[model samples]
Target: MAKEQTAEKGITSRAEDFAAWYNDVVLKAELADYSPVRGCMVIRPRGYRIWELMQRALDDLFKETGHENAYFPLFIPQSFLAREAEHVEGFSPQLAVVTHGGGKELEEPLVVRPTSETIIYAMLSKWIQSYRDLPVLLNQWANVVRWEMRTRLFLRTTEFLWQEGHTAHATAEEAEAEARTILGVYRRFMEEWMAMPVLTGQKTDAEKFAGAVRTYSCEALMQDNRALQAGTSHFLGQNFARAFGVQFQTAQGDMDYVWSTSWGVSTRLIGGLVMTHGDDVGLVCPPRLAPLQVVVVPIWKSDTDSGSVLEAARRVEDALRAGGIRVNVDDRESMTPGAKYYYWELRGVPVRLEVGPRDVAQGQVVLARRTGGKVPVPVASVLESVKAALEEIQAELLRAARERREANSLRHVNRDQLTEYMEAGGGFAYGGFCGSPECEVEIKERTKATIRVLPDPEFRSDPPPASCAWCGKKAVTEAVWARAY
Candidate 1:
């Protein structure tokens, strides 16, 4: 019995197999389930609730930054995409076209949205006829379809939900500023709310968003030491506006194409959350983003004990909820207190309150943390105790993740050392790039590690390398390289 329990605790331990452990946490925790459709999964209620919290927080940030919510069509005319040559070419392989609708063939095929840039700009062109109409900041909460050859639940799917912000400005400088503003928003949300640290920087041209003059990204290092692209901000630089005829009369009375920007973070962030904090047992959700931050379990052996324990449990739940916490009370008669502990811990509830006959009689309840701490607290002070524990847990998760990333990261790495590190299971490496596509391609073909970014000024190394790490050519910039999802 002891050995069996130990096996359960160690099943698919991340040290032995990270991929299996991730799937175990996601499926067994009831976050999501396999779906009937290929390359897609059904996000269960618990999973969706977490996403809802994320949406509410991110939506709040968008609104604070002068963005208004709007709706756009999910289907686009095939000709609309063709207006932008690079956009059409980049997404052609993943395009899902519908030739027949309402049981008849349509005159022209309609393409499900892989992204909204083209369609959104097509509309923006008609709306923005003057400088006053410029700087249109709009966002949409919607589902997008991109026929990915491979999918991993919330990470990548045939269909996924996200908020895409599209903005148009009268000048390139204004549009660029908007893109950077969004980049900061994504970074702040991930680090402050999700308790995940990220490196922000400009993506290499080879990896930048299709049709974007430049793309900025937030790169998070997961527990497995691989990088995840958590979010992106793109500067369109009049590409879409020109292609869609979105021109505005300048304040000086001249007509010119509007500069544009698009930025988004999607359900893939859920996957990033799972990878950043989950442990061998299961998920380790941060308190701020957890769907249920606290769970109260009442222990009773008889009908007499049940009444008192239940009453105390409800009291604790109400107190915590009133204290501005997302909480729930679990009072299932069929399950044991031990079983309830395991279930809630696996689901990553940040804190658990155990109300038993003795604890209730003493006017106290046991406080348990998902990160593995337990103490008895008087009912009078349970709310304060829980709030402190939750705050500590949220901070600790971020600290531990950042420490792990730094420990594995190697700065000023040479080509050989980087290749060896990647083959031995990689982490981030600071190196130099020659700014040549051939150089980037050669390194990827050799090491399977791409440059995650030319890190922003804050993250850039002091006294940057004088030569490229691979070919020893004159270095144009310092880059962060890692094997990524």
Candidate 2:
């Protein structure tokens, strides 16, 4: 009986097998399922709801920052990609070409977009003619295909849903500002709503987005102490504009190319949330972004007790709903109270309320928190308690993640020290870099760790080390290195 319950309700120990545990939690919680397609997965209703919440929050942020949502074609002409030399070479391996459509071969081949820069820029070139159209701030929530050889559920897949923001500006400074602004938006969204801690900085040239003059990214440390690139914002700096001849008449009446930028965060964030906050039991979703905030579970001894207990549960649920809480009453007759607790816990519902005949008689109910611990609250005070509990849980999760990141992060003065740290169960290593692509490549080959970020002041110190941590050459910047997902 114990073994069966463990098998049915528990996942593989995270310490023993983190990958197996994550796959089990994702499947058993009904968040998603493997699809018939070789490297695709179906987002079940439960998983989609979480994504919907994320979309609503992020969309509102984008709109508030003066970005309007729009749509673009999913297919692009092969010639457009060719116009941008580095962009085409960067995406060549992942390009999925469509040579035939409508049951006939076409004269020109179309490529499913890995990213929309080429096509979007072509349209921008047609739409802009003067300084009046200086900045075109647009975003699109759509699906993209990259033809990935290896895939994970939400982290890396052949096809996935995401939002990409592309903007055109009159000056390089304005374009750089737009990219950083979006980076701030992404950092706040990930840290505040998702309750995840991240390091924000510039990516090294070798690791930056292809065709971008500079790329900025947010890197989050997971429970397993590996890094995840949560989101990125790229400063295109007239590269795409020049490729597509997006020349705009300036205020001074001169014809010059416009500066451009693109930034995006995808469904992979869902996977980051899981790995950052989840445990051996299952996912541990932060309250502000959880699909369902509160679940009401009723406990009854007999049919007689069921009548009163369920009535009380409904009253509690109605009260919670009236208090502006997302609530659901689990009244399944076939499942026991323990079973319901396990079910809701596995799904990472922030709070669970259990009402029984005794609680109803006493005018109180039992509250269990997914983060851990239980308390009892009177009917009159349940709302306040629930709200307080959720806020506390959200803050606690962020605090815990921050502490874990700090604890695991290390500062090394040389390559030998970096190697020792990597061999001893790596976290993030902060060191000085010479800013040479060849040096980064050699380091990756030796340690399997690449520069994750050239961290901000908060994560980096003043006056970088005197020489490169790896080569003892002139140090250009401080960088955080890690083995990533």
Give the Cα error of residue 267 in candidate 2, in Å: 0.4
lDDT of 2 by residue, 1-485 (tens): 12222365588778877777778778877888999998889999888888999999999999999999999999999899899888988999998899999999988999998999999999999999997997899999999999898999998989999999999999999999999999999999999999999999999888899889999999999888789999999999999999999999988889999999999999999999988899877888899888899999999999999999999999889998999899999999999999888888889899999999899999999999998899889988899999999999999999999999989988855889888777777889998998888889998999888899999877786555777889989888898998899
Q: Write the per-residue lDDT of candidate 1 for residues 201-222, one digit (tens) a residue.
A: 9999999998999999999999
Model 2 residue 335 lDDT score: 95
Q: Where is model 1 more than 4 Å wrong at Cα?
A: 1-11
Q: List per-candidate RMSD values in Å.
A: 2.2, 2.1
In candidate 2, list every pair of residues with a backbone clash.
Answer: none
Model 1: weakest 10-residue lDDT segment is 1-10
lDDT of each: 0.91, 0.90
In model 1, what lDDT does residue 377 have?
92
